[model samples]
Target: MSSFKSYFSIIQVLLLFGYTGFFSCGAGAQQMASEVKEVKAPKLLFLNYTISKDTNGTYRATFINKVLTEGRLKDKTQRQPLSDAGDIVCIQYNDKNDVLDRSYIKNPLQPIVEYVNDDGNLEKRQLNLNSAQIAIKLQLQEATSSVRLFLIDASGNASTDLITTSIR
Candidate 1:
């Protein structure tokens, strides 16, 4: 009887140690996976603007732009309108003094819309104009770390003063 009791106690001790080791290893793997996932950055930071045509054949602009942070949107504002007739210019400048300027006709204005979806997420759709220009701007901003945008009118006036945003 004493021999049997000794063997059973040894088995119980070994089983307890094995169970603890298995759970600790699993917990460590989960922690490592979370650390690896934390290295990735957010996907996109979006800006919304509206470009419309005025009676004078000039362009008018209104925008509500925001930044995406930690799966949430912030820094939203309704900007003042810019009414100017002439060629419209979209300029993107970076801290490195790199600048990209694109010009568009005042007529046949394109509208860029940004709205919240049913899930309370921000969504964007560009109407009328080719999206290539905007895509380029977004790419440049991502590459440069930070970017400042300016919309200029045909009269060489800035339609919207130095709108800036940064991406993660």
Candidate 2:
């Protein structure tokens, strides 16, 4: 009977801690969302994107991003599991206005761990992946509003891929 009582007490304590932690985490996430609503770095980060263009000259850019958040909440030595929260931001422009400076990069964001060729194995994508892909959609003369995607790095550098889509 005494052992059962101890077990019950332990369970109650765990529940209390669990509830407290849950609320704390919820508040933290809400705070983060309010602080930065969109990503602003590392231009041309993309897994893949499809562009649908038409006449009339409308333009829009949409961004889909996953941020890497690391926390030492579990064991001090071991980090917590990753959090996968998707942030979607969109900007729009019409050919009638909003001219932007543009630059292009090919195969910009590499997200591969290793490659095996005639050589046994080659490690790859090291130091990269500071962020996930930002899906951008361009529509010209079609009246699309999505404009740009960006991210702020730890050093507070705003890395961005800029595009100019408007009438002209």
Candidate 3:
């Protein structure tokens, strides 16, 4: 009878603390899951850059075709993709819409010598291709104030909206 009583007492103690322990463990796991999800990369899609000359004599560059994740437009690198014919089309936009000053990003998938403006200008200084290319290249500029980016695919498929960023 004494042993039974002792066992019952132990069970009661465990019941008292079990819920608290379970809740704490669950809370910790929940936090870790959310943190992992937050670090996920944004989806790649075709977007476009729209430049409109405002009445105040300013060219407004806006990015459109946003992926519906919370990670879109976050500080990340964006590199142009290679084409099926071993060619790459480079699209360069300055802090402003001055496309003349754009850099040609080298593509490892192919030897893309012509991946520059028709006027013979290079894009980036040549770097290893990586997953974070787009996020790193697309950024805000203080001189241009606000610039939006659009994703243009290899086949020239694009969305008609703007991904806006404030350079200030």
Candidate 4:
């Protein structure tokens, strides 16, 4: 009877701590989110950085298309897939969509671009010819505060909406 009572007591203690931690963690996350400013895809900005600063204060940037890796945007649930031979454009813009820099990826899957890896090393990478999506890197003159990217297919189907990659 004592062992059974001990087991029940331990379970009760675990449940108490687990539920308490879970609820508190959620509330804390919510509060932190509320404190932060609204931004479009903030995590993406940090991941695929649109800007970088060298040690000499010379800031440079690149539009590395990590999302369009496989050459096509497809959803199994969707009836039609957005993929073809056309172009993908990365447009850097100001707050009011003033175009700052425009980079195009034509014949995207057949590039000999000097890709800068995460370690800041330049590497020669090439995309296969049979790629469905546009795959290339575009070096920018300088980092901008925001970017809007879109793709247009040969069949005249464009990206449904603007892909805003911003740090504002």
Candidate 5:
């Protein structure tokens, strides 16, 4: 009977700690979100390429690219699982609004690491070379927004394959 009572006490203590920890974590996350929300940065980042286009009318810019994003979360780190989250890849326009550079990059608010988690929260690891792609249009007066990519290295070697999407 004494052992049973001791075991029950241990369980009770554990429950108390667990509840405390849970509340503490929730409060921390809320604080973090508020702090990051004050920051000003692009919500979406992507890579785009100019595919085939009609050169006859002078509108000859078609691009293809990928976009990365963490929807609704001000902090990229506080994101849903990659698979569960919406499209991380995106297509966008260039900054200059001319000639559809098809090889433009934008700076991201933060870097991201490709990670899979069963906990439902998307895990992000900051890469070294952060970059983004965009497409620009001149004559038609259509320019898309900037798309940013997080590189794992300063030299971007590990991200070279990803960077390839920018090439013609």
Candidate 6:
């Protein structure tokens, strides 16, 4: 009877330790998750640009000297633009409510440039930082009268609100 009591006590202690260890690990995981900060996307400023038709009757748009703001634009008062260096920029162009093309620029010190090729695909080209303007050319499809641009930072952790251009 004494041996039985001892075995029962040992089993109870083991179970208690196992349960405590499990809960501790779970709590630690939760704490780690809580410590992780959410990344924000960068804001984009579409500066002076133009959409014109080429000789072939194809619609093309050029985005000149677009600016990318690093952090969130909470209000008109608080504008946190990235200084010194530039972040990865991803731009998406939509026409006729359809995604026409997507471009990703890695660390663009110059203007973030994009263009549409003859094959009707949107292409992103790199330019020199000293260049006056970063021209983004987008090919417009048939029945796609207007296009909208969306900008985001490809680098992980920056949350960006939807910075859209006027339908044009």
Of the candidates shown, which would achieve the greatest lDDT relative to the real structure?
4
**Ranking by lDDT, best first?**
4, 1, 6, 3, 5, 2
After TM-score superposition, the amount by which residue 69's alpha carbon in candidate 2 deviates from its true location, in angstroms, is 31
Ten residues in sequence with the least summed lDDT for candidate 6? 76-85
Query: Tens digits of per-residue lDDT for model 2 on 1-168?
Result: 999999999999999999999999999999998998664322321223322223532222333332222222222221112112212222444444453322122222333466665778675643333233334322222343334433223343334333322222
Query: Per-residue lDDT tens digits of candidate 1, residues 1-168?
Result: 999999999999999999999999999999998888444453334455555545654444554564443442232221223445433444445556576423233323455589999999999975655222232213223344444445555576755543454533
List the lowest-lDDT window of 10 residues for candidate 3: 127-136
C-alpha lDDT of all candidate models, in order: 0.50, 0.38, 0.42, 0.51, 0.39, 0.46
lDDT of 4 by residue, 1-168 (tens): 999999999999999999999999999999998999864331222214233334653323344444312123222222223345444556667666677755544434355668889999999976544333333333322345666555655665544233566544
lDDT of 6 by residue, 55-113 (tens): 65333335544443444333332123332223322234444455543433333345558
Per-prediction TM-score? 0.31, 0.25, 0.25, 0.30, 0.25, 0.29
| Higher-TM-score candidate of 3 and 6 | 6
Candidate 6 residue-pair clash tally: 12
For residues 1-168, could you state the per-residue lDDT of candidate 5 as single tens digits?
999999999999999999999999999999998887554333344335432213341112234645455333233331222221111322234665233322222223234667878987778786533233334221111344443222223443323222223321
TM-score of 5: 0.25
Off-target runs (Cα >4 Å) in candidate 5 are 38-168
Candidate 3 structure lDDT: 0.42
